[model samples]
Target: MSQVSLVAARIAALQQAGSALALLQATQELASCADASAAPVLVEVLGFNNPGAAVAAVKGLISLGPAAVEALLQLDPVNYGARAWAVRALAGIGDVRGLELLLDALGSDVAASVRRAAAKGLGQLQLDELPPDQKQDVQGQCLGALLAATSDGEWVVRYAVAVGLELLAAGLPAGSPERQQAQQGLLTLQEAADGTPPVVQRRAKLALSRLELQ
Candidate 1:
């Protein structure tokens, strides 16, 4: 059968699945197809209560890359679970189109997991693909968000902030102001004595060490 026909059949099977196991199997099959045409259906699967199916859909969307951005952006804002999954997919894809969403999620989302994903996504964004001026601007914005997230109450989120700062700094030119700022952010995390978790402190120390080597 043609690829389109097969994708359609897989989508039909996913939609018709009556049991959780069946849904996961169908979702996995559709996701493995990696057809851009399946993006919308894959996105819809994010809203399902099935974590396995959602994970498969996220992988499928990541494979679709920029083509999946629109559908991910169109997800219902009220569906926090779906939007969280979309954030992960967007982060994995690293498309610049999801920049604003990632920024917002990192800065304000109530879920630590979502915030952590967004922090990492901001660092992982494909800024090198943009013109020099635009890349600088976006990088600055990403740096600002990540630095601000360093104070997150959750140790896990703060750990992610350390990672994000390191990655963002690696993309910046050495001796640049943004790079300095990222390094300072890492130092603050590493030196914090206000009950910072040992893991977070170690992560920041490790990130700072890596940045020094770059």
Candidate 2:
């Protein structure tokens, strides 16, 4: 078989294996792929018709760590869900450079789910246990991204953004600038509560509680 055909066969077998665990392992092997020719095929596995396969593939790609970031991001925009998963997986690896890709994803993605995943990943990355100097700028940028998404035309996007902010704000000090900014953002959200959907209102309220309790 030609190298391309061989790689495709492996990917097909991995999909046929069907378990999340098996697919996860296949993703790992795919990530180790040395042939640039196989890269796109690896990404396609991430979009298996099966959600389990897709999730496993994403987990595997992420396990590749920083090395996989650029390739994952370069996938077609039609595959935004896969790309969003890649952003989360990158964050899981504790790499902040992925933050830029996350921000860009939020800004340009029309899909609420993808944007939300990026937002959530950004928040988790904030609590990465990095040193203050390293975490500060990214945290600020995360807050900004969440804020921008809060006003997104879609309720799902707004709710996701609020949830991201709340997760990132957890346990911040009463007098901290972060807490203050969160409170301000909540106030802005509250002012628009009448128009906000039930889900988003719930998220906004949760964020408010976290900030005020601080």
Candidate 3:
């Protein structure tokens, strides 16, 4: 069998293990594998009460990338807190399927941590790695979302937005409109710096300093 098949087999056994610790170990091992087949299993584990296993499972799903994104969308966690974790996981993957969810979470009544994760997740997308045709559309969507997020109620969410803008801008050239828009967003943050929390001010300032040099 191929490498992914072997990993699939190992993960199957680990999934059926009698203990959370054993499942945790399996998740750690899965994180190192590039198999997309493991995504659904990892998605289920995100709700596991064992923090370590849940975290490891999330990381593993992220490593699985777009394939894992498919599995994440099909999830409907009965536990409200599990839904938060699912949102956070979707954000981390930064897949297009998760984009709308992140955008909504940014403006929702959900936990601040979930909103913050959404901002960070958009920043983590590998847009530059996509094909030329797809990259443009994705960039536009991500930029619009990030720009809108600058007005979020929580300073933490705004801080993540600023950081995410910096990351998105980093992959573009100075003359590019997207890059310019990101810089403009940072300027908005700067103008409102005094009203924002200290942590957000620091992040906006740092992002501005970096953009100034870009």
Candidate 4:
């Protein structure tokens, strides 16, 4: 079958899946195909109450690459609730428009998940994709926002910040102040053994160990 027809069939199947788990599974299948045609349906899926299904849709959009980003940009979330989910999907699929949304979301009093996703996106950005003149400034802002968020009220947000800081530190010059600070911050998270979940603490420790060797 043609790729277009296959995506259509997949979208139809996802729409027909009444069960949340079934929808989630179908969504992931569409995502694995990485077809741009699936982006619109996935965007609509963000409104679903099922977190797992919404996550699968977000992953689908991310897999769609630039096509998903463009489609997401055109969607105006008149409903405030949908806006956070849109920002999250944007966070996973970085484009200038998506980056703009993430930067704003990072500083806003939005959902912890939104803020966490923004932090991760900022760290994963390809600096070279940005204009040369804006690259340094944006990088600094990404790291600054991430470092300041190390003590976020939510452990998950703090864990995401730790991951961002670790990734940022990995690419920095030897003995750079930012690298030192990022490493210190990750260590702090790791040392907060009791306060943090084992999973988050383990992530922090892993990041710190890698950064320590860099």
Q: Compare the candidates by lDDT and give the number of the best one.
A: 1
What stretches of model 3 exceed 4 Å from their correct place?
Answer: 1-9, 77-80, 129-134, 192-195
Q: After superposition, how far is residue 87 of candidate 3 from its true place, in Å?
A: 3.8
Positional deviation of 39 in candidate 1, in angstroms?
A: 0.8
Q: For candidate 3, report its TM-score.
A: 0.80
Per-residue lDDT of candidate 1, residues 1-214 (tens digit): 9998999999999999999999999999999998888999999999998999999899889989999999999999999899999999998899999999999999889999999999888988987779999999999999999988888899899988988888889999999989999999999999966978889889999998888888
Off by over 4 Å in 4: 12-29, 78-81, 94-97, 187-206
lDDT of 4 at 82: 56
Question: What are the runs in model 1 whose C-alpha is more than 4 Å off?
Answer: none
Tens digits of per-residue lDDT for model 4, 3-91: 98898888889889989889899888877778787888888777776789877888778767678887676666565555677777776
Backbone atom clashes (below 3 Å) for every candidate? 0, 0, 0, 0
Instruction: List pairs with backbone clashes in candidate 1.
Output: none
Q: Which stretch of 10 consecutive residues in model 3 shows the poorest summed lDDT?
A: 77-86
The prediction achieving the highest TM-score against the true structure is 1
Select the stronger candidate by TM-score from 1 and 4.
1
